[model samples]
Target: MKCADGGGGGGGGDTEAEDGGGVNVTLTTTTLPS
Candidate 1:
């Protein structure tokens, strides 16, 4: 489980915070050993 504590007042909210609407946002990631 996770949480998103955001305070984006239309700046990034109007930008990077998108999905299948043309943009994408990955909130978490895990990198396996190369």
Candidate 2:
């Protein structure tokens, strides 16, 4: 059960990470211009 839960959570985490990465890139670009 634990292994199954971890696998599911890992997939969700990857999607969140991709979204977070895009936001981070945008923030860094805005900061660099200032």
Candidate 3:
């Protein structure tokens, strides 16, 4: 579950307090480039 928490943080917010869609898109883009 730690990885899930980290994903939210890496996405930008501690949880869904921020725009999840934007964060998800950012994460996807970053993951693809590497």
Which lDDT value does model 3 have at 26? Answer: 55
Model 2: C-alpha RMSD to truth? 12.9
Per-residue C-alpha lDDT of model 3 across residues 1-34, encoded as one tens digit per residue: 4445546555565355466654765566556544
RMSD of each: 7.6, 12.9, 5.8
Quote the lDDT for 15 in model 2.
63
* Model 2 residue 4 lDDT score: 48
Which tens-of-lDDT digit does each residue in 1-34 have in candidate 1? 1122222222344554444222222232111111
lDDT string, candidate 2, 1-34, tens digits? 4444444444555566855654554455445544
What is the lDDT of every predicted structure here?
0.28, 0.51, 0.55
- Give residue 30's lDDT in candidate 1 (0 to 100): 14
Would you list the clashing residue pairs of candidate 3?
A: none
In model 2, the runs with Cα more than 4 Å from the true position are 18-34
Q: After aligning candidate 2 to the native by TM-score, how far in Å is the CA of 20 from where it should be?
A: 11
Off by over 4 Å in 1: 1-9, 16-34
* Every model's TM-score: 0.15, 0.40, 0.35
